[model samples]
Target chain A: MLKIENLQARIEEKEILRGINLDIKPGEVHAIMGPNGSGKSTLASVLAGREDYEVTGGSVDFLGKDLLELSPEDRAKEGLFLAFQYPVEIPGVSTTNFMKTALNEKRKYHGLDPLDAAQFLKLMKEKMKLVQIDQALLSRSLNEGFSGGEKKRNEIFQMAMLEPKLAILDETDSGLDIDALRIVANGVNQLRSKDNSFLVVTHYQRLLEYIVPDYVHVLYKGRIVKSGTKDLALELEERGYDFIKEEVDQAIA
Target chain B: MDVKSNLKTAYSQQEGNSTHLASFQTENWKTFSGMGIPALKHEEWKYIPVKNIFKDEMNIAIESSNLEDTIIKKSILPGTEEANTIVFFNGRFQADHSIIHEKDALVVKSLETAAGDEDALFVEEHLGHSQAYHPDGVNALNGAFASGGAFIKLKKGKSLLQPLIIYHFSDSSNGFRFSQPRILASIEANAQITIVETYINIGGGESFTNEVIEICTGRDSITRYIKLQNEGKHSNHTGTTHVRQLERSNTHAVTITLDGAIVRNNLNMVMEDEHAESHMYGLYLLNGNTIADNHTIVDNRMPHCESNELYKGIMDDQSTGVFNGKIFVRKDSQKTNAYQSNKNILIGDQASANTKPQLEIFADDVKCSHGCTIGKLDEDALFYLRARGISEKNAKALLLQAFASDILGQIEHEAIKNYIEQLISERLSFQA
Candidate 1:
């Protein structure tokens, strides 16, 4: 479903992602665990085609298409979603309107007929029930005065609406409580299918306990150093990322 | 007599001398020519440079014999079938074209005819007060050239079923023109009315509009005024609206400045009686090299009065925006609440905004606050929309529309609000 070859990216003159190479197939869920400055979010931003990040020497292929060559809108139309760590607070755009425009734009890109107002509202109601987001909240401006957990849940709600092929959860679980975490995880698990995949980028293993990734990878200094089963997340949580840094130093030496 | 003399020559060479200045008109002209167009050095006109727009000569259109019929039709409102409309061509009233039925609650006629009648006491009293409140030279110039002023008076305890639309059409095909149309409006107690005023350029050269409108709101009256300015690129406009709340009244006004080469609007509201309420909202979306400035002053002289103001600007290309809002609470004006906010979005690096919202409170028991924000479009919001498969252009338009909705929602007239919404959409879609 996704392939990254020597993904070297930078912001300004400072190199954030040195050389990242990752490969994941359909129906696979990958959890990338890293320290604070370990390029975890950088990888997500590069994959999502953020304009601020410059890919110095790398190539990203999503479903065998040149991802780096596409614009951000094209990247989104190609079924690539990035749930921002801190979702933006848009004051005037209502959540329902924003979501409807997004969904219809993506649908139009896929050559599908746009949903009418009644059908769109019906689908929104169903998705809202799945994520437990209230109807009144969707009527207000998107994240205008939302709480931390509400914003995170709203991101998940948007995910449920768009239903992207490759979902990149970038620190979405950081500000959520236990209840919201379970709800968000439940929504993601419900949307999971054999034809889709997820790249969960988080700093803690707490989110992994809920989402339960198929493979856990320790990323240090932009590169994924090790890959293992879910147990690796529990081990890393217990020992912390210092253990990974020591192992990396010893390996280099 | 340095720069002022040169300006006098410029004004005389363009507009020529008025032959009707035999009575009080000549006195007004002497008072006007004595003080040329106020420079940036003046206190009231400090933030605005008025000399640039009027540096050259501008002739008032003289040939009223040949007027374009299509220009008059195009200037009317979209769905104004029963409107009491007044058409002003080159700052002179076109009596043959204006239609004001006797049965309507509104009395629309020329200020010249209404001035000598005993029924026009309101017009006689309130005509020159705006200039008195703001004694700048440009205000005097408008008073001096007040050729064909429009008078609208709503009778006591009456509500107009239809709107009163005033169109100021500028035809400067011969040469540069200077047009001034004074407006006198008096809303009686408990009366409700909506007044829509706009400017139109029929044959464009260089046209300058120096207009003043005086409004007197009676006790418990409701008044709404909408000013829409989309003049030609060579047009320059300087408008002043001095509204007075004679008693406990409510006034809601929205000023939309969409496209203009040089536009300056001065709005002043004086709360004379207790329990008066005023709400002022403005939206200025300027593109190209256009410049728009809005300067407002709300004076709370009585007790328990409230006033709230919000002005937003979306500037692109090399356009510039300026907002200066001042709220003054007098010492005796206790229990007064005044709030003012100004926000501007600069789309390009070259686009700029100068916003200053000031509050001078002398009353200790009053609540007054003012704030201004000048920023670019939110990048995070832009990404959030674009990441949802929305095109970048549409995303920007959505964000801008949302930013403008706060002010647009204040339009009390549904048709006017819809008209503005469509205008904003068209403006956003036309990408230069």
Candidate 2:
């Protein structure tokens, strides 16, 4: 479903993603774990086509399409979703209107008729039940004065509305409590299907325990050094990323 | 000939017809010639190019207006269907074209008639009081030709059933049309009224409108005033709305400037009595070569008066925006609470925003704060919207609307507010 071959990227003059190669099939969830300054979020930002990140050398093929060539909106229309770690606080743009715009744009891209007001509200109500966000929150400005957990849940709600082919969760679990974590994880699990995939980028294994991953990779210094099953996340959580750093330094030496 | 000499010649031609106000007319015209068009070196006229707009020959269309009733009916502000409609064509009041919906609630008469007959004391006390704040030629020029202006008064202790909509239109088919419209309104004690002022330019010829509206509010009265300026790009406008609270009155004014060649608005709120409250809100959305300058003043003359002022601007293309908000707390105005803020967003490279928030407090027990901001649209906010599958254009419009909604939210009239919102959306959608 996705292919990244030596996806080297940088912000400003500082290289973040040195050379990352990853291949994932449909219906599978992949978790990339790393310490601070390990390019975990950088990799996610590059995949989502954030303008600030410069891809120095590499290729990202999503469903056989060159993903880097598309604009951010085009990438979104192509069924690429990024759950920002820190969702933006947009005052005056209500969540319902914002989601309606996205849903209509994506639907229009695929030659589908736009949903009317009642139909859109009905769909939003169903998704709100799934994401456990109240109706008032959707009516207010998007992410403006929202708690951290509410922001994460709103990201998940947006994902449910979009139903992307490739979902990239960039530190979405950092600020959520146990209850919010289960709700968010369950929403992702419910959306998981053979035609869709998720790239769960997190710093802790606690999120992996709720939504078990098919594969876990330890990323260090912008490179995914090791790949294993879900047990690897637990092991890394117990031993800490220092052991991974030592392994990387020893290998480099 | 120079603009001042041309204006002097025009003023001399009109002074001969007036009998009751001949002295008043000549005095103001002398002031206009004495002050003339202020140069750019002048502090208040620094960024404003008032001299350029007045350089050409401008003749006040004093000829009795042959405007149709249909024109006045069509020009009534939306949502004011039940309102008392007052119409102005070529700076002169069109009485036949106006409609007084409620007969006894208020009285509408010609400025001279109102000054000489009923409410003569009000005319003597409050007429041309805006000149105290704006002593420039612009203010005096409007006062110099104040004939055919409107005189509106609300009955004591009686609130109107609906709003009073004043429509100012410029029919400039003959030549470079010049209009001077003066309004003297008095709301009696315990009365309530909402006054809305909107403008329309009917002809293709270039036009300039200089308007001054002075309002006096009695004790415990509530007044809401809204000014909407959306004339075409060929028109230039300078308007002053001066409101004085006699004692413990509440006044609210909102000015929305959408488009014009050059527009200058002076909104002054004089809180003269104890516990008087006022709010001044404005929004200007400019594109093309439009320059919208909003100058507002809040004067707290007595103790315990509170005033809040906020003016915002969004300038696109090579448009320019200027916001100057001044708040004054006099020595006798102890415990006065005055707050003023101005914010602007420049959407184009050449688009410029100039903001100055001035606060002068002579009272030791006063709380006064002023702030101004000028910035470009937040690129991060733009990216966030685009990432959600909205097109770049839609995203930009959404953010700009959001930035403007705080000001747009001040409009109390539902239909008029929505109408202005539609115009703002169209203005914001422009991209080059």
Candidate 3:
């Protein structure tokens, strides 16, 4: 469902994502693991069309369309979602209201009629149960004073509402407690289907244990040097990334 | 002829029209002539070009108003049909066009009539009281025409069934029109009232309105005042709302400016008695070449007085917004508390904002805090919204609406608040 070939990107003078290649079929999950400053988040940002990063060279194809040519909003409308590591706090905008706007905008882009109030509320109530989120939290300003767990759960709730074809979880477990991690993973598991895919980006392997990935790739120095099945994540968790670094250094030498 | 020569001619024409305000008008005319229009060098008037607004020859003479009742009725704010309506056309109070639903709760009269009647003492004590704080030609210019103003008083221990709505209309079809509408209101002891002031302009010619409304609250009384200015791009306005708490009273004021050529508002709260409290809130949402300038002052004259002030601005296009807040804690006003904040967002590249906070405290036991900020829209916040499938335009509208909701929430009157909210949403092209 998504493909990236030699996705070379940089931020200002620093080259971050250098010569990376990845391909994911529908109904599959791919986990990209790396150490600090290994360009894991940079790849996610580049795929989501964040303007701060410049794609010096590469191509991204999502369901036969060039993803890089679309604006951030257009990319979202085209069923591309990015769960930010740090959710923004927007004052005076209730999460419920924001989600309604976003859902309707996506519908309008696909030549579908906007959902009525009753229809929208009904859908929201159904999704609220999936993520174990409270209606009161959604009624308040979006993440204005939310706790770490609440913020992560709210991101998953938004993901459920949008129902994107490909959702990139960028460090969704960074600050979440164990309970929040379980809830988020469960929500993603419920939403997974044969027509949708996910890219799980993380520095730690704990998240992979809950939503086990079909494939695990180790990213080092902006390049994926190792790829294997789910067992690779368990191996990395036990041995740490130093072994991977040593192997890459020896190969370069 | 220039505005100064025309004003001089008008002043000479009404020199000997003996009335209750003859001496007051003459004195104020002298002060205005002495100071003239404020130049850019004047500290308080530096950001606003008051001189340019007066460069055109204005018709200072008060011609008989021929406004239609239908137009006046159409101009009344929604959800305020039961309000006590007062109409002022071309600076003269229109008694024939006004209405008082609850006669026993309050009294409304012409300033000229009230000055010579039993309320003469009250009017004399409160009229032109804002001059002491402003001390400028703008205040004196409005003072010179005080005889054509209105006088309103709420009876002791009485509360109006509904708010009082004042509609100031100016006709500039014939030429450059100039109007001065003065109001002196007194809330008697234990009384309560809400006052709303809005402006309307007829015809397309340029118009300038200089208004002064002085309110005095008696012991334990409460007063709420709201000013809404949206008179289009051809209109210029300068208004002063001076409120004094005589004995532990409470006062609240909100000023919202949406569109105008150049608008200046002066809001002053004088806490004259112990334990008095006041709140001042303002929002100026501008686009085009509109300039909205707000100046507020809080004077804590007695002990244990408290005041809070907040003013926000959103400048789009090439618009400019200016804010100057002053707080004073006198030596006798021990244990006083005052807080002031001003925030601005410049959406256009050429849009600009100027904010200044001045605090002078002579009491060692007082607490005062003031702050100001000017910035562009939060970029991260914008990107987050865009990433949620909302168009960039819609995202900006949503963020700007949120930025303005802070001041909008301060409006206690439900209908007026909803009305202002609708105007803001329409301006931002926002659905909600």
Candidate 4:
């Protein structure tokens, strides 16, 4: 579903993602694990088209279209979703209103008629049950004073609402407690289908325990140095990223 | 054609035999002459320049109180069909255009008649209570020419089924127009009511409106007041909504200033008895060269009283917004709780906001807090919305509306609230 070849990027004077190459097919969930400052989050941001980063080199293609040419909103309209590391707290806008706007806009891009009030609410209820989100929480402001778990579950709820072709989870497990992690992972697992894919970016392999990625790639110093199966995640969790760094340094030497 | 002499000419034209009201008007005229119009050097009117707004050739209407029915019909708010519609043409109460839904529940009369009616003593005692809080010319200036104002009285223990909509219409087609509208509302004991005041400028020329509304709530009474100002750039306004809460009474006031050339509002909440509660809220969303100045005062005179105030504004283009909120707890008012907050957002390079929240607590045992903030839109929040398939313009508009929702929530009337929301959405559509 997504192809990234030598995806080099930087912010200001600091180089973050350097020569990253990754490809994910339909129905696949790929996990990228790295130490802090290893460009894991930067890769997710670059894919989602955050304007602050300079694309120095390389291109990202999603569904045979040049993803770099689209605006952030247009990218979403084209079925690209990025679950932010820290969901913004927008007071006064209910989660219901937010999702309605996003869903309607995405539907418009597909040349579909906008959903009426009853239709939107019904769809929201179905997705809400799948994500295990309380009905009262959806009536309040968007992520305003939401718990760490509620924020992640809301992201999954939005994913269900949009049914995107590609969803990038950036540090979705950063602040989650054990229970919250389980709920969030269950939500993602329920939404997994044959046509959609996910790029799970995390520093700890603990998140991989629940989602169980198909491909485990170790990122170091802005490059993907190693790739293997699910057992590689347990191996990295056992030995940490230091062993991967040493392996990359020896390969360069 | 000086402003003071023009005011004198208007004051001397009243043929009424109400000696007490005449004497009160004379004193205020003296005060207006002594204080003149505040200049840049004055502290209260520092940001508001009153000198440029007063033209020597402006005509103050006295006989054109007959407002057209069609015009009055167009000026009514959305859900006000069942309301007691009170129309004021050029600051004079037009009985023909006004409606009294329930004569037993409410009594609407002119200030001239109120002075000679059964409520004469109550009117005389509380006529100029707002002037006591200000020694400046602005409050007193409106008092100097308090001609043809409305007097609204709620019968004791009787609640009205519909709200009261007061429309202040200024027809400046003849030339420049000046209006001084005065309102006195007495909500008797155990009575409850809502009063919504809106402005209308029907002409193309310059208009200056100086209005003062004083309300008194008796024991166990509840009053909700909403003031909406959406006049054109040719109109300059200085208005005040002064509310006094008696023993065990409650009052809530919301001031919304959308657009005008120069607009200044003074909202005063005076708590006179124990266990009294009051609330004051204001939202000023402006663009162009519009200037909105909101000054609020919550005076806690008795013990065990509480007052809460919140005012938010969004300024764009070259527009400027100013907020000055003050809470005063007297020495005898122990255990008083007063809180005030003012926040603003500047959406343009030339847009500006100045906020000052002050608390004056003479009692050592009281609790009072005041705060103010001025900033631009949050970039992170903007990005969050855009990443969800929303345009940058729509994102900012949504976030701003969200920021304004808490203030909008205070409007008890759904039609008026939705109408204001619609106006704000249109105003914010062009903003990024």
TM-scores, one per candidate:
0.92, 0.97, 0.98, 0.96
Q: Rank the candidates by DockQ, best first.
A: 3, 2, 4, 1
Model 3, retained fraction of real contacts?
A: 0.67
Recovered fraction of real interface contacts per model: 0.88, 0.71, 0.67, 0.76
For model 2, what is the C-alpha lDDT against the true structure?
0.88
Q: How much is the lDDT of residue B138 in candidate 1?
A: 83
* Whole-model lDDT values for every prediction: 0.84, 0.88, 0.92, 0.88
Model 4: lDDT of residue A195 = 88
Candidate 4 lDDT tens digits, A98-163: 888888877887899999999999999999988789999999999999988899899889888988
RMSD of each: 3.5, 1.8, 1.4, 2.1
Task: Find the candidate with the highest lDDT and give its number.
Answer: 3
Cα lDDT, model 1, residue B205? 84
lDDT: which is higher, 2 or 3? 3
Q: Measured with DockQ on alpha carbons, how good is candidate 3? A: 0.72
Q: What is the Å distance of residue B289 in model 4 from its true position? A: 1.2
What would the per-residue lDDT of candidate 3 be over residues B1-432, giving only the tens digit for each residue? 778888877766653545557778888999999998898899999888989888556878877889999999899899898899999998889999989898998899999888888998887777888999999998998888787899999999999879999999999988778999999998999999999999999987899999999999998898988999999999999999999898999998999999999999999999999999999999999999998999999999999999999899999999999999999999999999899999999998999999999999999998899999999999888989988889888899999989889899998889989999999989998742
What is candidate 1's lDDT per residue for A68-187, written digit by digit as tens? 999888998999999989889999889998888888888888889889999999999999998899999999999989999899889889988988999999998897889989999998
DockQ of each: 0.58, 0.62, 0.72, 0.59
For model 1, the local distance difference test gives 0.84
Clashes of 4: 0
Q: Comparing candidate 2 with candidate 3, which one achieves the higher TM-score? A: 3
Give candidate 3 misplaced runs (Cα > 4 Å): B12-19
